[model samples]
Target chain A: MERVISKVTFDLAQTSLRQVNHFLHRELNSETPKITLLNPDGAHNLAVGLDATIDVEIMGHTGYYTASMNKQATITIFGNAGTGVAENMMSGRVHVKGFASVSAGASAHGGLLVIDGDASLRCGISLKGADIVVGGSVGSFSAFMAQAGRIVICGNAGDALGDSLYEAVIYIRGQIKSLGADAQIEPMMEADYQTVGELLAQAGLSYQPQDFKRVASARQLYHWNADADQEY
Target chain B: MCGIIGLLIKQPHLRDSLGELTVPMLIGMGERGPDSAGLAVFTQTLADPYRKYSLYSGGKDFPWQDLSQALQTQMSKEAELQPHGNQAVLTTDLPSTTLKPWLKAHYPQLHVLSTGRAIDLYKDAGNPTEVADRYHFKDLKGSHVVAHTRMATESAVTPAHAHPFTAGEDFCLVHNGSLSNPNEIRRKLEPRGIHFETDNDTEAACRFLEWRMREGDDLATALQKGFEALDGFYTFLMGTADKLALVRDAFACKPAVVAETDEYVAIASEFRSLAHLPQVKHAHIYEPAPEEIYVWNV
Candidate 1:
């Protein structure tokens, strides 16, 4: 069968990448579509909520919700992305070559989301299955309310990262503000570091695995007792 | 919303006595999902059939007596069904080999499904205390469990979609996060005669596991494939009859923490979930590895 998305096209001059999504929805019948964003300056939601076999390559910066609710596609944002990039994505790969704004990849489920640059507040907030590898720092409340998966922050994190979280895994190489809710800092053994190292490598991020510290929940928030008037 | 908890022990002594430990643990998590509570207990029976006990309360479904009586009559005989106001319980004794068929025959209303070696489930609309009081969780004890306290974003508030669903024998799951590819996966699985009860995305995860299991993939391998195949945000806790496992989506948008020592290992959405444990001395907590799978054997 013919490849889902075979041709490479650019709509920078055409303006309104809306047609791109519409075209993709019609043409690429696969769960993921192979796309090439040709230096689009201000495209918003270039590939959000597309559940086909598709791969997207953005050569330039993007606007909000670049890949929200994505499934089975590989998205590469060659330049910076605006607010809420990859929000609530389900399955697929999202790679930002440059910085991303607040809530990048927030609440995403199963998939690999890699950010080559720094991210703003609520990065990965309330995140579910998504695995995030940030090459740079994360803003406050990273992985907040996170239910599962791994988030490796290559740089420092802002205040209250991982607050009130459940079972998500986090690894950071730099300083962090107070841990939120049940989150805690833990030592990284060789076996653990090796696993972290390999995951980072798979995300195409390079760093000294030893330099990172691991963050997780203390398992306190999973329960609440009314008679005791306590919240876990 | 509803509350759920599943545990799997590594040691045989711990496994056999799981009922004792799990009864209280489920009650402890009851507050997180207070709207309704239910517990399913599994015991190993090589000679006899696999045994499953389910206890829950009918919170606002109808009057307490009416709901309880209906449940009791529906789950009578083979499964001991008891309803007490906001809580109810059901027990079934079966051989391990017949667990799958037993679940299919008796708990079809639950719409059970599996994920890797663990079962996946959904519970809607209940508080932890309400769940315990309604489900009679005090009577439940098992080697392993995985539960949830639903905020009710999607799906109904019915008991049919509650957490700790069973896919086959000895498997259950609790999850946090949304699945994006449920329709696609559902469309694929429905043709295979795999039934569905609710509209929740987690059912896709269960069907994904069932598909992988049918293909002869081991639990861990199936989970890894789930990591690659399923789409959406998910940080899930799963339990077999004798083991507990955790799986996170690639983004890790949600949070999961683990506190461990030589004696016990506790996982939760927050530290307070395990803070009640008296044995937790200076608990060291950390997040699951990205795209990682953690298993505790019983």
Candidate 2:
């Protein structure tokens, strides 16, 4: 039997975010189909708290917290997204066709977030587990306190890349202003090359993995030492 | 939190729509800041060689005509007074240095917002839309504009505490973060005979840049010096007669984005503010790096 695909549309200027989210929640786990949102016009907290295997498309620019706390949902933003896009996501994919603002994928446990355009400061802060692929440059303090996952940047990275990171992998093709505490440049091996190539392929980007520099934790700052503590 | 917007038009055809385009961008961040709003518009030079001073009066129905008449009599030159909301621009043949001191000594109730050959500033403590309407912003035509919507982090919500603080003859600045060491810098600038009207930290940063420029430092050199001397989280959009510049702190804690098209260069605290710009879909968008100065000249 062919599964039926259901479609829903909400214009935020006419309807409220609460109403739209409520309808989405009710439709979760049913057919798990497509939803369209229009006239977002920089409104905050849109399409939040979704835990279904559904597909959502936002037509215009959105404010903070767009597509946050997602689980098994494929969300796409046709225009720019404000701060905290795809924040704390557990699974699924969120793709931004336009630019994204600060804290693009903060504290996401799992899933893949792809930004076709540039992302601003703190692109992947405190990521427990996730894969973030940015086609354009990312601003400073990116991958700060990252616990796990892989972040691939096809363009340049700003200052303090991967600050205080633990066990996470960061790949950048362009210049890095500075490396953060506990983050060190590591040579890209065959496995790293294959992994980055796969992620870039998934992101629909065609960049050579050899062009990127892999970064990982130094493991020196993970354990607290009395002498090191005294230096602070 | 605050919202900063700047639009610099490269095409002559788009110059008339500068204010029309900026109003919506400023209002888009209404949620980030609702306390006050301000803007500095740079228009074509006056027909005659004259300096324009933007002045604000706390009270409505300010005696602008009387002031103009008084200036005309005192300075023995033609003076024109144009009022918009609580703000007014005084155009005169008198030099800025002489006119500024004379106005300060005479009109204690009026506040000088800015003085330049092409810049006119307007601001008020109210909702962004209301303030924009009050200033009749839709009717304004300029080559570029720098605007701010303030949330009042460290200072009182007054007209004087607004952003887009004018530093020198045509230099203005708008900030989106708080400074950690404003008083210390203020103390250093005061001994150099720099004047201050508000306790806002943004004003301190503005004065510091102005003083550096006065001491023969160019805009780029002054801003580079500012990166070393100024402390705190900040994303600044500064403008002069011919250029617009952006800079962030080393940490890049505050948010800022820049988008450029063949027609114009627009910057805002968020991408949402830049979404509606003309040819934005094809615009080259990017985020500036920390401690790196990006400047665009007309």
Candidate 3:
């Protein structure tokens, strides 16, 4: 016996984002899967707060907070995504076929956010434990204040790549204009290469891991002291 | 929070659809700012010898015809007043320097939204759709348009407090974040003969830029100086007679997206505001870096 996949479609032009989100919450679960969102038309807060192992596809561009706080949902945006995509996600995957605006994957705990095109400023800002892979370039402050996670960029990185980073690994294949406070470029070991290779493979990218540089925190500025203010 | 949208048509053929294209963008930002809305339109038709001034009378039905007759009598020149709901556009051959002061000295109640050779402004405190309909915004024709929906974080909601603040002739600015040090800057500029109309912090930024320009700095230089002087988390869209400029604060907390096509350049607080634009899918979309100035010339 074969199992049937339940697929639901919602057109945002005729329906509100709230109604779509409500339908997603009420109908989506581990048992019933798949939703097709049409005519997103850059609406914000679409498919937010999803905690099921379902497949959600958005046909067009979306505004802020798209697929934010996702626990276990495989979401794909066919078009561009606005600010804060997949922010604070716990699990599953979110893929963007087009460019992502500022804070593409900010403060996510766990998930795989794959951006096919360039990501704007603060791509992985305050990231906790997610894995982000960008197929194209990323804007400045790529991993600012990231406590934990891994970010792999197949292309270049903008200024101040990993500012104030902590316990997070950043891999960039192209040039890094500048590094932020307490962030330093480290020699990639064999294990680090393997990690980058795995992240690229998971994001369905074919970049070579040997052509990348690893950036990590120096751990010197972890603790503050009033007496160490001579530079100020 | 506030919403900002700007459209500058590069193709001469698409210039007539500026207002029709801008209404949807402004309305899309209704969730971000539901308090009031304002817009400024620039057309080539207004490039004649006459100057146009857009004025708001605080929702009052003022004697616009009488004011126009008086202005014609006093200035000894032809003047025309066209009213639209609570706002009106006054066109005259008088220079802004003479006309603005005269209007200020006489009708203090009429708030001048903008004055320029090619710009006309309209704004009010209400829903963005209702405000746009009241002024027949969909029927307006222009080469470029800049619109704002205000949430009023720093000041009370009034017609005077709506955005697209005009400081210099043909120059207007709309802000999306709060300024931390406006009063201090206001006090500093007050002694230099810079007059302020509203207590809104955005007005302070507008006046500061105008003052910088008055000091012989070009628009780009003034904006670079603004990065050093202004303190806040802001994304600003400023318009001149022939250009549109954008700048974000160093922190880049506020959101802004810029999309450019061969036919046009559009900016908005979010991507949704620009999603309805023509051929936006093929447009090159990106976010401006913090402290970077992006300017588009006509």
lDDT of 1 by residue, B118-184 (tens): 2212233456555554444444444555666655456666665666555655565666777788898
The local distance difference test score of each candidate is: 0.66, 0.88, 0.89
Candidate 2 lDDT over residue span B145-164, tens digit each: 88999999899998889878
Interface RMSD of 1: 17.1
How would the candidate models be sorted by lDDT, starting from the highest?
3, 2, 1
Q: In candidate 2, which residue ranges exceed 4 Å CA deviation?
A: A12-16, A27-29, A154-156, A171-177, A185-201, A204-214, A229-232, B47-49
Q: Give lDDT tens digits, candidate 1, residues A1-232.
A: 7544465576655645777777766766433435687855535678888777666888766666888888877888887676688898899888998777678888898888899988866899988978899998887778989988789999898778899888888999888966777889878888769878987998877787888888888886566756756643
Residue-pair clashes per candidate: 117, 0, 0
Model 3 lDDT tens row, B1-298: 9999999999988878888899999998887889999998887756556888898887468888888888878878788889986789998888877988898899988888888888899888889988888898888887788889999888999888998899878889999999999998899899999989889999999999999998999999999989888898899999888899999997788888888999999999988888888899899888887888899987
DockQ score for model 2, please?
0.46
Quick one: ranking by TM-score, best first? 3, 2, 1
CAPRI class of candidate 2: acceptable
Q: Among these predicted structures, which one has the highest DockQ?
A: 3
Task: Name the best candidate (by TM-score).
Answer: 3
- Enumerate the candidates' DockQ scores in order: 0.02, 0.46, 0.67
Best by lDDT: 3
What are the runs in model 3 whose C-alpha is more than 4 Å off?
A29-32, A224-227, A230-232, B45-49
